[model samples]
Target: KIPEPAVAVDAVSITPCGEGFPQCDFEDSAHPFCDWVQTSKDGGHWVLGHKNVSIHGMGPS
Candidate 1:
């Protein structure tokens, strides 16, 4: 006889951001989140990018 799975599969539900937590879409502004700030200490910063990044075969298609 086959053994039953340890955990049962059930319906999944996702809670939208800002309801009880925070989220960022990185679409509207340079800053990703409300309290996020860019720093130059590492000589790199976060910037919004399109669906495809500059280099080919690197980013999402």
Candidate 2:
């Protein structure tokens, strides 16, 4: 069984990207944006790459 969170989560605070906010281009940087975090609980995770992805038809064009 899943354990309940210790504190209430406020989902309404989330927002879309706006001016002055740094976009998630997944470029040069080694990590995700400050507001984001990396997790592999599902046995899969994000990989940072350049130009194109290794798996065909999977990532950016």
Candidate 3:
């Protein structure tokens, strides 16, 4: 499992991408943005990768 952190961010674009990984499990399906954030915040498993984004107003812009 990846190490969980305080928070995570999906600083990437959600628009049509050329290629990507297939949604595997629950986390992959739900968190189309960033899973590490909620996962870590929820006290679940830790995520290794970190997205550079502001935790404040992490909602749809």
Leading candidate by TM-score: 1
lDDT of each: 0.44, 0.44, 0.43
Give each model a TM-score: 0.24, 0.22, 0.16
Report residue 35 deviation for candidate 1 (angstroms): 12
Cα deviation at 59, candidate 3, in Å, is 3.8
- Output the better candidate (2/3) by TM-score: 2
Measured with C-alpha atoms, the lDDT of residue 34 in candidate 1 is: 37
Minimum summed lDDT over a 10-residue window in model 2 is located at: 52-61
Clashes of each: 0, 0, 4
lDDT of 3 at 50: 35
The sequence of per-residue lDDT tens digits that candidate 3 reaches over residues 3-33 is 7777777586767623232233545555654
Q: Which regions of candidate 2 deviate over 4 angstroms?
A: 1-5, 24-61
Off by over 4 Å in 3: 1-33, 39-50
RMSDs, each prediction?
Answer: 12.3, 12.2, 15.7
Clashing pairs in 3: 2-46, 3-46, 3-47, 4-46
